[model samples]
Target: MASPRFLLLFTTLSLTVSSAISGSVVEDLANLQPPSDFNTTIMKNCQHNPSLRYCNSSSMDLKEIFKFTIVASHLCNESKNPNCVHSFDHIDLRNRPKMAPLYLSYSFFWKYCPLTVLSIDLSNISLKGSFPKEVICCDQIQALDLSLNGLTGEFPIESFAPLTNLTFLNLSYNYFSESKISDSQFFKRFNDSSFIHSGILPSDRNYTIKAILLLVGFPISVILMAVCFGWLCFQRPDYLPRMFQRKHKFTPSMLRAATNGFSRKNQMVRSEGVEIYKGTLRDSTQVRIEIYRGCISREKRKEFVEECKVLVELCHKNLVQVLGWCRTRNQRAIVTEWTDGETIEMWLSGSAPPWKQRLKILIGVVDGMRYLQENWPEVVYDLRINSVLLADNHEPILSRFQVGDQYSNNKKIHKFGIFLLEIITNRRSQEFERGEAGLIEHVRDNYPENLHKVIDARMKLPENMFDQAKHGIELGLMCTDQSISKHPSLNQISHMINKVYESCLELAPQNHKRSHGDGVVGKDSSNGESRL
Candidate 1:
């Protein structure tokens, strides 16, 4: 057995080797194809269609790590002007036997390609159901053509509002329920062509008199059926959940009083153009209020309400619960359960936390993140040290009140990697020397060989725990890996982190023995063997 001091490092190294071997075996068993292979398959599938020649693998670098960009805009259009978009030329997968449903194949294709798909021209692919929330995470998507598809449910114009870069969208010939689309500036960019086939009759189906007679539909009976169907669809459920309904929806005046008339004394954070104030409700419930600065515009207010509806539905122990919201003609604020602990960023600015505390926080973060991915289809764009609040008991809670841009698990994984590095190094990426670049970039560049250099200077990791810390760093790298296929699932990551923690627990006995001046015994080293 290795000495207790080196056991963690040895275990980490061994686990890495085992993981690689097992990963390859799993990949083979699942018959999963690499990104390059998937790209080639896509190209071959589109070969017969001349318009889809742009689907060529050369247009995208599937092997490029950590960067996403579209290189060929002209492939979709013949116009000489670079900005001109005639049509999103490559997404027509209609009648293709090998091509899977969009939802089933979404993550597979998304991760394989280096470029964020700018224009999706899926005009004839018989897609159905509510808009696939997955596609919205592609922040760069500019044009979407879902015309002639069988899409249903409420028109998700509000969901698309965050895609600031979106320029053109066509949802014609699809089954979409009527909703207020013109209320937002985001929807205003889309014209009448976007709503062509309300998916309702006469564009939908024409019921003939003969067919109606065969179904025993008299004029009065037909009218009653139509009325019943409309009522059923409209009364199915509340857009906002019943649990979120509150009788004590605080008015702006009440909030003002609770927050000391919006005084600076109540302010908790005033960064990134966001102001958060700490306050107590009349019932003495401690709360945090996030106030959005400019007066709520008519369009913006509608979007906020819709977003709140979704936010209120989420419930997780690791997440800061959103209690209620206040919106008046002049102001908008979202209220959440308050915490006495300082921001993780603030805490990190001091001495490094104990290894156990750090591990606990990391586990909490992973749990919260996994919940977000499973429940919320959107990207966690606001994950950062400032967003993580530590309680008096040092428990970590992830918080987000406002709806922002679309982000995906891939982006979250990358940010989580940076967060891990920050916790370990006690330095912000922006604070790095100009030549060194971001934290992940610098660490990745120096990893395995010079990793010790990146550890927080103040953190004297016990020799036994050093390998555990290194193991965590490796997990961070895996999370931030450029190759999407290599990235561990949320559950896998959570398990790995917990395993490292278990190893720490296993070392406790040996450390105690050494501290008591008990000469190291073979049994002591054996007791220190990693439980993982």
Candidate 2:
């Protein structure tokens, strides 16, 4: 004979116990390790939940889900099921801030399952705290989305590097500053529309118009302008010729003092198109003066000067600053800001800085390319590694725009992808060693692995970073596919690079150490001692 109150409490307790017991598919799974098959039971029970939209339990294996977004309600693992594995690719854990702890726990699951793509688009979730570095361990992850979250910290470039498999990444709609990772043409293939709020049209739309303009309007304009200008010049030879003949005169004495009298030893750099000499004015300001000869026609020389003038008006961290230019008999000289660092190629060959410095250099290259592609639409052209030069601050600035075809067509975007792969792998595009006939045959015979070997040997890359690099190489291969139609757009390529970078960052190690060494050149030992 129990009292009424005690009877009611007992019944309620019984009902709660029964409900907890009945709700879980697995009664005892707490001790099992990850990659467990018990995930099938949980999936089966929670399949109807809206949040688990991307996950399917019919296959009885978590690996079935690939490149999907998962949003589920009432996701639970019984304390007994320790071996459960949750494998959802490109998951969006939005509208569920209360599930933060569960999301954090899934990162460990990511390590065990090695997802190839993951997106935690927690937009409007107002999530806090820094991302755990362990997320970088997902070596297979190729894409990551953590955008629209309240994440705070420096741009986690190092963390993202490990996710070499990543091809699309988004950290947009956050409160980040210059510490934000610099852009690369590699990232141009991906979607960047959500990052900046400028109210501009999508890149795809702009690219279409530019392509039409370049392919149709530009050629016509060039021919029409050339004819009109040529006719006008012929009629008014005195006026135009006099303007061109106004020689920028400099005294022989002044030239000698500016360049130490053209001493060969004083020349800082020599290239096919230009020779750069280090100089100092009477005021003691150091300068770099580049001399160009034999490349431009007399008529084209004026155009070149105008182009330089336009370039001088443009100022950016990625572009080298031009101080002034002069045209003398049989020669044209342009003064520019001197960069302290060496070329990226030199650094890759172990001729200059250490590996950590090289990573920073890569970031700089990305920044410069982003600037060029984003700002100077008319000059958008194919770029290569040789165009990337390290500055005095070891920052990378892009030059040598004169080379490569400039076309507004989206097809040119693939070239940027190839360059991105080159940077990560530290391999020359033309220099790749092929099997049988040549490099192409070799690459065709053994892709991915052969490509992986192209990575710089100076530093040990994390697994995820290596995977991201591998994915990038694959993307490059796709871009260079014999069938041009298979190639992706620059926006797509950018998205891919961003994804890889984000995945790498998520899985990067916590105790990883990087070297910081002096910027001076070492003796050119036959064994990796030359200055890059």
Candidate 3:
């Protein structure tokens, strides 16, 4: 053949041209436009019955970007599509080297498609190189399932910042050598479901490191190199107010004493993410101190403080009061007024609270929820029965205001109303095993003639209260309507309850009457005898 240099040049040019052609093919596949008839066919055959035709259509061009159009909420696994059991609408190949070309094609589709969920279970997928820094642009993605992937790199905090709407992020079973993310930052942005596969230790290493640096390195560095800086700061103390200062005023010794030297016996309650203890201040005011032991970042601590301030400012006779808070080197604690009453579960399951008292408890809880929804600024407390705390008077107080960012969307107002309905009806929203038939189905399935059978059996529903209960039930059903637009606001709900309450008052007999022997009462009017 030709000269050695010429031959080498020819081979290199050939390989470059071949690679370009291959890349072009993948790009074309990703950018393929849907056929004009595609929408018509999808709407006719799959729109209403997405579960049936989503991933089962053999005729559809599954390799092309247009294939993602088949995804719909109804197409979720509950539909029982044999071919599409594990079928996903989007596959992310971020930081994947061997799959770089595939990732490029995927990026094309990801940018074009309206995907809500992305499943990239690349757990064992060999990623020989470091993670791609530019792969953080998938902003609309709600679920990022990347567990079990061979991702050998430091935890990517910046990569996750763009995924603000992510509800589920599974990074378990991956090779992460260093822990750089804070627990508070983690919990504030993502829920517990976000880290299902990742092996997370109980103690947050990130927070510990920051605490050490603040307590040791920063102080020494300031003293050694910034003498004038310290003097100027000390002289112009008015520049920083005492309340606004970042000083660690609460000592570990004081906290230990307040918590009875960390006695397990004194622990009032312990949940997965938090712990509560009965504490006494110097004033001897009893306080229920709750320590949030979850992962949260320093940057997000200010937001958490603002949220806590809003909660503390809330004033209502039926609501629990937040007394004060303590922020130390290692932790954050919220102190609230103590309540000694048993939980609703205890009163209903136990033998202490009587039937009439139980009815009053229910009324008190509903009233508390009503007040919060109406009065609280930019916050809605979806109080579950698990969060209901009882006072010494046996009155229920709604507590624990934890909800995802979905609560802030105006579109979800109607959905919140439906949740309230579930509380009143005492039924779970997702009653069906495979799929949720919703609150309406649950109510219709369990309607009772006696009203007491459907209501809390622990309480006696007044005979004259049947109509009012029905009104309440009807309001609940209306709020939980399938269409989100149809549900009433909390203000509307308050008006409805008030109107019903007024009607009940007008219907009540003026004078009390009793039956001859059983002590049961009935109103003896000229018109007819009404049961009390």
Better of 1 and 3 by lDDT: 1
Off by over 4 Å in 3: 1-252, 351-375, 380-382, 402-440, 447-453, 457-462, 499-532
Over the stretch 229-302, how does candidate 3's per-residue lDDT look in tens digits?
A: 55434433223456643332333444567778868976988888788888765457776778876556776666
Q: Who wins the TM-score comparison?
A: 1
TM-score of 1: 0.49
Instruction: Put down candidate 1 lDDT per residue, 95-165, tens digits, no spaces.
Output: 43233262234343343322324665556666778776656655567776677777888766667767787
RMSD (CA, Å), each prediction: 37.0, 36.6, 32.2
Candidate order by lDDT, decreasing, is: 1, 3, 2
**Candidate number achieving the greatest lDDT relative to the actual structure:** 1
Cα shift from native, residue 452, model 3 (Å): 5.6
Model 2 TM-score on a 0 to 1 scale? 0.43
Residue 8 lDDT in model 1? 15
TM-scores of the models, in the order given: 0.49, 0.43, 0.44
Error of 1 at 372 (Å): 1.7
TM-score of 3: 0.44
